[model samples]
Target: MFQSILSNLAIILLGHLLMSTLITYRERFSKHLLYIYTVVLFSTVSITMLYLPISFGDYRLDLSLIPLIFLALFRGWKITVPVLFIVSAWHFFMGSDETLSSIVFVLILPTIFTLLLYERKIPTNINLKILFIITACWIISDLPIILFIPNGMEIFKNTFLLRYISFLSVASIYCAFILIGYKNDRLKQRLEFLASHDPLTNLLNRNKFIEIVEVKMKESDTNHYIALLDIDHFKQLNDTHGHLTGDSVLKEISSIFNKYESDNLKVARYGGEEFIIYLKTVYDKQAVRTLEHIQNEIRTTPFHSNNGGSLHVTVSIGLAKFESGSRLYDVIHQADNHLYSAKNENRDQLVVSFD
Candidate 1:
């Protein structure tokens, strides 16, 4: 009998599409752009729903609560607060006699429900949990309308069941929409990370390292130093142990590099058993001390094989400070020369360029 909510139902569907698209594609958009987009998004949908409300036999109601609740649960306050504020201000300013009731039911009640549930542990699956809260919100908001307003019981009898069913479906569909979009975004981020990082050590891969180094070198006037380190007798150690053990040793060395890494320094896996470090330092001595510290840490740290066997390990380091007018490869070649010199003389030593 009450097919009048068709427009509101359609509005809810549009809201679903709008919100889902934003959630899925937000990584592509800048932070400020997305911020404006969300505020406009929720405010527009909410205000439109409120203006074109459904006729509940005699009372008028809008399906704005679902989006408000969704925003609260997922987007948190940054997006939710401004959207809530914009919608609330519009309703309070442009509304009629039932404006107070509209604020309470359409805006405040659902938001409070979401706030109480935020980050608190609940025992049920997400869909059911959301359903329960939606139902509670609907019931609470309708009761005052059902009791205080005229013919409240008669309106409840005529339209409550159908309206409830429609809105409950909208809330569940909105939940699914958000979940699928969120999963897609996360998967995209993971794939991007894997593409640019070495899975074994989770360090920057060779190509990514070169990309960053080129940019950093061109942009800054700071003194830059490069150090190339290679494991001493890595092949022999792998032959004595196993490939798994070799992998463990590599990861352990990566962890030590990570410990010393800072904003001024970057580290990457150049190739097998070889790591490159780049840093900005005012004094050549600082570069020497840093490389020496890394060299010492490697010597002292225990290396383990796959079968839990303890093994000895050491690295030879070649350090060179970048000259302003020269190319990146020139410095790398110089570092390589020093590295071979260290290996030829003795293993487990640090060699600095005379230049």
Candidate 2:
């Protein structure tokens, strides 16, 4: 019996590891692919539990509810509902009528009930809640057994200690996996944040900005335009006021850009003193008007310096509207050329080309 428990535990731990890995990369796959993988995983764990049981007289106990509960708690009803049907149906079809009915009812019915508990209140004190729910579900599942089996109450009273131990063992494994899944989620979030945002300004960095724009260009049905804006005399500002002031100016401009940003517009810090914006505007007049608004906003805003002084700045914008079959680099180059035209013509002007 001890060896059988150990073997079952080993299988459950392996399943948990796979599940943790999948949770880490859950956003990487399509919903349909993830659904298939989750169903397959739960089915394997269920079959292993069904086949391998700790036997006492005519009764066989398997720790199958552990993973089933985990499925509902973490993956939710979208995946868990289908998994419940598959695992329960498989057990009901394959084993002896008495054994399978007992297993299926005990495993499936109580797990669904526990899912209701979880859905209503996702407690902050999760570990204690897990133990409580699993124990409660186990006892609740056995109510039918107590009523139906011959001398059922007496049998339950005798085997209460064994049942507690089995449930505790499974609950411990579930707790471990839950912790691992949360840790992986936190780590993935941190990684994604660092990958997509600029450390200095908290704006989308150049690479991520370009990647998003290219994706939008591919997916968009409407016309989009890319505009590059450069701060006038930024190097001179850094030389005169120091890099600290330059950093402050960048942060100030990023805040303004973010304030004016909308669903149809994206603002990114392209590089030093250069910002990139993408607008989902089909008409040249709309794009020009939006750029003009931003240009005026920056021109009028004052940047406060550390030495109780105020600095005024102007920006030069170069805009290029995307054409059919035009690549991102090509559009950007056109914008860059127009930017130089604005800089050459005057430091505080806008140069745009719809052609």
Candidate 3:
């Protein structure tokens, strides 16, 4: 019994290691990973069925609990139920009538219950509910064998109770590891996002924006436009109202920028009251039209503050097209110069320094 338990545990650990490695590799080769996992799991189930068998008195046990539990937790019920049925049918064909009947009851009923639990989306803390249901099924399935044993109560105490306790402990530990891994992955993703994004407007921050622009500049043809836009008299707005109102104005304008974004364009919050738009397309006229539309949108939209007051805001936009083999900073400097010119000249219009 101890050897059987150890063998089952070793098989489970080996399968887990293989699955973890495959899942890690799948992150790099996302297209074929699911196919690989399906094949591996199916093969594992087949091989395990051929090798392991449990014994109690004159009754034999189908040592399929590990695979059934794995399928229940990972693949859920849809695939598990069919797999359980197939394995039970195979056991029946192998001429273990008593074991086959017990296996059928154990595998099929627990799987159905598992499916219902999953459908209900029960809390993860309800492992005891799962344990109770599985224990109930196992007890009912093993009752005939228990009654036939020489010392039935002693056999139940030594075998079924001990095995069930061990299974419960191991299963709970397995679930804990899975939950921890998921939480760790989530934390890593959030940290990566926070590193590359601005907290204020939830836009790409200045540093990431520059890195993206540099990469794009290397691949850019001679016609892509880079525009720098600044909110006019933004400091005065913050001074007149509060910083809270200024934040509302920034968020309002950020929403306007989001509306104008497209696959060919990238938008970033360059700094306080300043934003950048990188347009990849060669149409300078369309770029001008788009910027004009954004300016018009901001001009017409009355930004409401938390204090039940509304304020109007305008932006000065400067557009410069990248010439072939031009430095990115030089193009940005020219755009900035044009933006200052717009602030000096029209305060609410776009100035183009198309090359």
Candidate 4:
């Protein structure tokens, strides 16, 4: 009995490890690839249960249902549906007389309930709620073994209690470990986001934007255009309306910048009231058109002030083109020069230069 318990514990540990591995690779996998991994995981757990189950008088217990239940709760139908097919096929091939019954009572019913429960908006304490639901479903699934199988009541009274205890013990420990892992993963992602993004505007910060621009310049064989944009008379606006208004205006501008962001276009907050844009393409005309669009949008939009008034502002833009082998500093310097020219010549329009 002790050896049986240890083996089952080992299986649970192995399942947990496999789940952790899958979580790490999830970002790299598409929906189909993730489904394939889920199928493999389900197959392994099923095989482990069939070959090395804890024996009772007329029933066997294994942690095979652990992965199935957890994945169904956490991953939704995209993963759970495939796993259900694989496990059902395996059970059918095993030739157990109870195969049909198990499919309905054991797997199908619980999965249906789990899916239904998962769609509801969980208000709070989500992890605790899920754990409770899983435990309830697990105990509910074990009812047939306790009531219907020959001498099941006697067997459960004598031994299945121990099996239940073992199962819950392993589950509690493993779920706690996974909870910690979830917390760590969330924290890591939060830190990465904070590092690259402005907290106020949620736009790319200067350092990360420059880093990306440098890499793109080095790798792309085509021409790239860098534009420097400055909000005209920003300090005067801030002085007139206060810094709160200044912040609101900046956020509004950032939203407009973000609206145009795409694979070939990147926008970032260069500094206070200033932004930098990187546009990648072979045609300078396309880049100029995009710049014109951005300028027109900003020029027409009136920033709403906190004191119930519309404040109109305009921006000066300087555009410069760079190709492979051009220095990043030189490109930016030229753009800055053009931006200064725009500000000096006229406050509301763009200045573009190629050669």
* Cα RMSD (angstroms) for every candidate in the order listed: 3.2, 4.7, 5.3, 3.4
Top candidate (TM-score): 1
lDDT of the structure predicted as candidate 2: 0.83
Candidate 3, lDDT over the whole model: 0.71
Give all candidates' CA lDDT scores: 0.80, 0.83, 0.71, 0.79
TM-score to native of every candidate shown: 0.86, 0.75, 0.71, 0.84
- Candidate 3 per-residue lDDT, tens place, 1-355, comes to 5565556556655666666666555667665656656555754654474465445555445445545654665567666766766666665676544555555555666566556555334365655765665566556556655665578677777677555655555555555555565566568779988999888887889888888888777664445788999999999988888899999898888888888777677889988999988888767788888888888999999998668988888899999888877787888899999998999996997899853
Order of candidate numbers by TM-score, starting with the best: 1, 4, 2, 3
Clash number for candidate 2: 0
RMSD of 2: 4.7
- Residue-level lDDT of model 1, residues 1-355, one tens digit each, is 2354566656766877886687677779998998898789878887887766666555666777777887887666667878888888888899878777778776887787776676533334777777778898778667766767788788787878877876776677767767776677778889988999889999989888778887778756578877889999999988989888999999999999999888778899999999888888777888888888888888988888878778878999888877868688898889888899889878798898753
TM-score-superior candidate, 2 or 3: 2
Clashes of each: 0, 0, 0, 0
Q: What lDDT score is found at residue 13 in candidate 2?
A: 83
Predicted candidate 2 versus true structure: per-residue lDDT over 143-251, tens digit per residue? 7658778998999888877877877786687678677767777788888988999888988888988888888897567889999999999999999898999999999
Task: Compute the lDDT for candidate 1.
Answer: 0.80
Candidate 4 per-residue lDDT, tens place, 1-355, comes to 5677677667767777887788777888897887677678766775576556666655676556666766676667877887877777777788478778777666677776777666433336877776676667677667777667787777667875677776677667766776777778778889999999888888899899989988888756677989999999999998999889999999999999888999789998888888999999878888989998998898899998878798988999999988556798899999999999999996886888873
